[model samples]
Target: MFLTLVLVVGVILVWFLVIGGVCSWVWSRLIACSSSWASPYECGFIASSPKFDSFSFTYLSLLVFFVVFDLEISLLLNLPERVVGFSSFYYYFLFLVVLSLGFLSEFFWGYVRWGY
Candidate 1:
């Protein structure tokens, strides 16, 4: 329990520090601007808009697919390192077949079909 808490806190702290540092560095250039200064300098043009636009469920589903597939591919890549044999190749091929079939099923169901 304590270890998880520490890890979570550490991650949040580092995330905040990195974001704050980058924002501070970016906005620091605006301090020397020659006009009414608030926004980041863009060679004399200041532009602003909503921080986040409208969200889409389709886009969200696509993002989830990307993450899940990426994680699976990463794990698949490690299979060769842990199990070195001809059977490992068979397992890898099987995994790929299953993954492809899963994606096709999702496509047929329109869970990740484009423009759906």
Candidate 2:
């Protein structure tokens, strides 16, 4: 009990020295050469021209489909290790049915098509 108490007190002391009390004092005493650290451009003038126009929803949608299908493929890959009983098999089948339905609906809706 005494050792645990001493260790707890030491931890509390170290915690305060690390952050609880001395950290604010140290930051308050430090100084920066320039105050532009908070600005978007600290070392140079900010550019007025816009150059971020290459993004497209087509690529975003494709990326989303890739992620969803990749996740489903991973879950399918881990089938043997995860399925331990009838309940697990039932849930797995239910999951497969749900994903297949979603995929079929997407196919019928023209979302999943050639070149896409």
Candidate 3:
């Protein structure tokens, strides 16, 4: 039993060490190959011209909200199989109400616009 535990721990440690080394080498290579220019520029285009556009806060907020909402939906979808009670429905309803409130606030603040 002791030998088995030691072997398992040793294998895990070696696996982590190998993974870390590989990740570090790849990160170093990427950094070395990157250009010195901070601003994004397209090849065959004037470097001085305005290049990459920044995402606005409205778009970012909507993206974050939708991602989180979808994650919540996926988590809740499994609840019916695992849980058997009215409590699950109550929690699901509460979550939907809160999510709706958030959507309303975002709409009022103009984070979610009509025209894409």
Using lDDT as the measure, the top candidate is: 3
Clashing pairs in 1: none
Question: How many backbone collisions does model 3 have?
Answer: 0
Q: Point out where model 1 deviates above 4 Å.
A: 1-37, 40-54, 79-83
Deviating ranges (above 4 Å) for candidate 3: 1-54
> Please, what is the TM-score per model?
0.46, 0.49, 0.50
User: In model 2, where do residues sit more than 4 Å from their true spots?
Assistant: 1-54
- Clashes counted in candidate 2 amount to 0
Considering summed lDDT, which 10 consecutive residues are worst modelled in model 2? 31-40
Provide the lDDT at 34 for model 2: 44
Per-residue accuracy of model 2 over 18-82 as CA lDDT, tens digit each: 88567677665563444655565664647575656677777876898899889888887878887
lDDT of 1: 0.78
lDDT of 1 by residue, 12-42 (tens): 9999999999999988876757454555554
> Which candidate order results from sorting by lDDT in descending order?
3, 1, 2
Judged by TM-score, which candidate is best?
3
Clashing pairs in 3: none
Minimal lDDT window, size 10, model 1: 42-51
Quote the positional error of residue 92 for candidate 3 in Å.
Answer: 1.3
Estimate, for each residue in 1-116, the C-alpha lDDT of model 3 and write its tens digit.
Answer: 99999999999999999999999999888877667543344345666777657977768877898798888879788886965788678878888888889889979987688777
